[model samples]
Structures are given as structure tokens and as C-alpha cells.
Target: MAESTQQKLVCSRAKAKSDTGSSVTQSSSAPKRKASTALPLDMKVRCVSSIPVGPLVYTSRRMQGMIIEWDEFGSEQYIELAELQSMRNSSPAFFENNWILIDDEEVLHFLHADKYYGSAKSIDDLYGILKKHPNHIAQLVKTLPDHLKKTLSIVAYREYTAGRIDSIGVIKAVERATGLSILSN
Candidate 1:
């Protein structure tokens, strides 16, 4: 009787092993998983100031600290997102003057310069305003004197005749006319 019981136990163990093996085979025949097609959340930014306050590397990767790169001395440091926010809050002017965020598509979104430039009564005042907020060039250009606007029109016409009219060229013309270094570059 004991021998018969032992044989029955062995047979049940074999049946269980076969069941597990069949499940393993089924799993092996299953389709493979597809690769991820998501974009990364990494970002790159530059300090647009004459005196860059932070690191020499201006990139931030996912799960990594943002690198702040200073242009003046070519120094760089890795800082957390919270720390970067702290720096910006602590020195708003420095942050705004230096690190204006450009979108991933390289588009610049600036605040309306009306309130800032409206107070200027003369070209000198406009120059001073631009000296403080260089990012306001586009909106402020509309508020320029009629003669200066005509000059800019002439410059734009020249560019149009040349088969290419980029905003940078117009801005350069503005700098030449106004004698203000609106762009850090």
C-alpha cells in the first residue's frame, strides 16, 4: 500500500511540473513589448546677461540637476530645480536680465513692453529702459520715434531687397540707430 501511495505522489508531482512547463511555453510565445516613443523633458537655457551669474553649462537633463554656466569666467555648477528657483526669486532683475526662458522651438515669449516703455518721454529714456530690460526690444520698437521708425523701415527694405529679412538684422539696425546693446551677443 505504501508503494502505491508513493507512486501516486510522484505522478501528481509530474502532472504539476508539466502544467508549469506549459505555462512557461505559452509565455515564451507571447508578443514582445514595444519601445517607448516619448520625448524627453530635458531643457537648455542661457543667461542673457553681460555678467552671467551661474555655471558654464546651461543644460538640464531628466533626473539630473540643471547646469548653470557663467559666460564671464566660464565657471559652471550643478544646481537643483528648487535652488534655481530660489536664485531667481532672490535676484529677479539678475534672473530676468540674464536667463529669459526660450521655448524648445527657440521662440521667445516676452511680456508686453507698453507699461515699461510708455513712461519714456525721449529717446534717452527709452535707451535707459532698454538698458535695464533688454528683452523688450520687439514691443518697444513700435514705440520708437517716427524718424527712427522710418530708418528701421529703410533697413527692413534693404533686407527685403536682399531676399532675407530676419528680426536679428532689424534688431542690429536698431542697436546701430539707438547705440544701445540690447542683445548680450
Candidate 2:
């Protein structure tokens, strides 16, 4: 009797799918997954490092360690907060020099405010900083206000005309710094 009832249900489902022109199929024994909740505000962070960081998993209020998904493989990993704290306390420069920030946008904005390198008082100073730290060109441009960008563009152009800098490097740097095209071809 139960078999007959199951056959009828399956037939009905097949009929329904045929009527709707649907190709969907699911085994009755297949496990259903629950929808995952969004991460808490504290857990979300913007990674500024050239190296990737994490989508950290919060365990519990009582736990001192947090789970970090470092790779695509499901390897269980845990890092102690105390150990990280100790490292930070031992050498603050490790964090600063590496330019790793696992914090919210506001904290990053605060850090960008004349902290790593002081603000340029003149266009020459700005150009000097950009030339010295080519790796930081993008980050420096991001931090600059519109007026500074304009000033920097003028300085870059002058340096290029004076043959003090390479045309390709100057053009690329100025475009990145000022958000404007120098030469098309």
C-alpha cells in the first residue's frame, strides 16, 4: 500500500514537471542546506595588504581563537587572538611596514591621514614621494584630494618636459594620480 502511494506521488510530480516543461530533478534523500546568515559588522574587513587575509569565522564569546579560511580546501585552522596581540605588542612595525589592515573603511581612512608619510607641502615634494614609492602609487593617489592631484599633474608634466623623468612612467603616473589621460598614442 505504501509503495503504491509513493508511485502515485512520483507520477503526479512527473506529470506536473511535464506540464510546466521543467527539467528540474531532485532525489528525495538529498540533503537540503540552510541559508547562511550575513556576517556581523565586526567580522567584515577590507584587506589592504598585497597579500590576502580572510573572511574570518566567529566561533563564540568564550573562545579566544577564531577560524580563518585561508584557502579553497576545507582545512581546519585556528589562530589565537592573544598570540596576534603579543606579536603586535612585540613589533608594531611588522604591521605598519607590511601595510596590512584588517579593519573597516573608517579605520583605513583614519590611517591614511598623514600617518605613513606626511602630506606634501609643495608639488615637488609630492612628485618626490610618488617617484620614491612606485609601489604605493595607487594608495597615495587614493588618499590625495582633487587639488593635490591637479598640482601633482602639473609637476609631473613639468618633470616630463624638462627630461628629468621618463615619458612612459610620467604619463602612467600622472594618469593614475590625476585620473586624466596624457597622450592617446
Candidate 3:
């Protein structure tokens, strides 16, 4: 019975992976990344939701650079080649034909390109980028460095809710409170 149950669990996980075509998994033998202390779920959500996602890399004479310019909406966003794939996965509608940029003033702009430019196709694709790939949003967050911890702590402290409990982490709570995400955008 126990063997059968174990097999079932394995099958379920495999099925899940197959369904999404997501093969990325945290490396068991690899070193663990540091984790920040617990903050309000809403605060963490803000970190994810506040992220301004977009970028495409172009090659020059044996070099590559991604543009960091203002987008159609006027936000100071950025999009690198890899991150664009992730951005598309997270919000296919937002990133599909389009690109996002951020101006010096930190506003988001979105624009559609004439053709598809990257290979991200699902939410899992975006998650993989953020969770594992280079120059991804999560990578950017992790790159913010120790000095910013104080700034982050201050931001986290400020992002916490003063009202009733919502730490249980239901989708409804996310929708009802933050609306579109952690910071109301």
C-alpha cells in the first residue's frame, strides 16, 4: 500500500510537470539561496507585484546590451532578453506582442512589437525565470544587496496592513486587498 501511494505521488508530480512543460526544479545538490525573514504576505506580494518587467537584448560587435528606456506607459522599466521570456509567461497578454520600459522617473510603458521575440509561453515560464534564470526579476531582487536591507525593511514595514488579518494567503485576499497585486498595481 505504501509503495503504491509513493508511486502515485511521483506520478502526480510528473503529471503536473508534463502538463505545464516546466522542467526547472531547484537543485537538490546545489547550495541554497538565502531567505529573508518573514514579512506580511502582502508585503512579499508587493515585491513581486511591484516588479516592472520587460527587456530585450541586442547584439553589437561581439557584445550585447539590453535597453533601459521609458515604455509606452511612462514607467521606468527594463527588459532583458531572458527576462522578457519570463515576463511573457507571467502575463502573456501583457508581454505577448509588446514590450515594457521605464523612464527615468520610474514609470511603466508597454508597446507591441511587430513580431514575437522570445520563447516564454506560460506562468510557469515566468516563475522559472524569476526563480532561477539570470537577470530575471528574482535575480534583480536578490541583487538589491545588503545595504538595501534597511530600505527593504522600511518598505516591508510600511507595506504591512494595519487592519484585520489576511495572512492565510487565499487568492481572494490577494484580489480583494491588493487588487492586481502587492501594491495596488
Candidate 4:
């Protein structure tokens, strides 16, 4: 329903923050700090990237080398590592040498999979890294099935392609640097 008189100021800066006299709630219209966080205390979402890792994970079928959008809303997801490795071994396609993620809900990466596995770098920093490498980028762009390429994720690919996302290999290195877990998919 309605947010009442608060929350509206969050998107508007000047109106937020407490003045000398007012109820704490009415004056500070900004979002309160979250008491709990999934990231390290020092980390924050400096940028928001919705890069297409690949494919629509079908609720009915198992897919490989891809992150599935959970049926439930919001960002949490599952990766099927066994399916990824098996797919890599069997498919004619080549995937980025590693995978990147903030959490490990599944498996380990394969022989050549570049493990850019973390939620560490500021989104801008990571985005810069992805932009530098052509081959890695080619791999990412190609990973999308032709249909997805033609659809909305194509927009994701284009945005990243326009900006700088370091090579998948480079992001993989950062993953190792950040000490994040590597899960399957």
C-alpha cells in the first residue's frame, strides 16, 4: 500500500535528513541503514549490473553453464554445477573460463572456466575489468542463445559492451582476490 509521509524523500535528496525540530521519522526520510547485510561490512553496491550470465533456466528442464532465475522474486538464485560441467564437456560451445557470484549454492568450476567468483569489487570497478578483454567479452556475448540475444538480455550485453567490463579472466582474478566462494553453474 501506501508509504505514508516517509520513504518518498529517499529518491529526493534535499527533502531528506533531519532538520533541528521534527519527529525523527518525519525528518529523516532516507532509508534506514540495514542492520543486517549479506556483503562484508565494508562493501556496498557501487553500481548495479544485470549482466546476462546466460539462458532462461527452465523450471522443467536442467540447463548448463548458466544461472537460473528463481521462480520467487528478488535476486537469490541456484546454479547446477554438475549440469554445468557435464554441459561444458559435451557441448560444442566454449564458456568463459570461470564463473562469478556472491554466494555458493552449488558446485566448482571446470578446467578452463575463468572463476570470476565474487561480489567484491565496486560494480564500476568490476564493470571496467569486463570491458578490457575482447576475447572474454566475445565469449560472454556468444554465450547467449540467439533467441536471448534477440531479446532483453541483449540489452544487457549491449550496455556492458558499450561500457568496460573487464575480461572474464580478470574478473575471475578479482574473485580469488576477494575470497568469495566458487559454486557450480
- Predicted structure with the largest lDDT when compared to the true one: 2
Q: Rank the candidates by TM-score, best first.
A: 2, 1, 4, 3
lDDT of 2 by residue, 52-132 (tens): 233323233333563333341112333343433343455444244432333333333333322432244333446565475
TM-score of each: 0.25, 0.33, 0.17, 0.23
**Off by more than 4 A, model 2:** 1-118
The window of 10 residues in a row where model 2 has the poorest summed lDDT is 49-58
Better model by lDDT, 2 or 3? 2
Error of 4 at 174 (Å): 19
Candidate 4 global CA lDDT score: 0.35
Q: Residue 65 CA error for candidate 3 (Å)?
A: 24
TM-score quality measure for candidate 2: 0.33
Off by over 4 Å in 3: 1-72, 97-113, 116-185
Cα lDDT of model 4 by residue, 87-171, tens digit: 3565413233122222222222232333333322123333443454544444443443333223223333444355543244644
lDDT of 1: 0.43
Backbone N/Cα/C clashes per model: 9, 0, 18, 17
- lDDT for 142 in candidate 2 is 63
Which candidate leads the pack in TM-score?
2
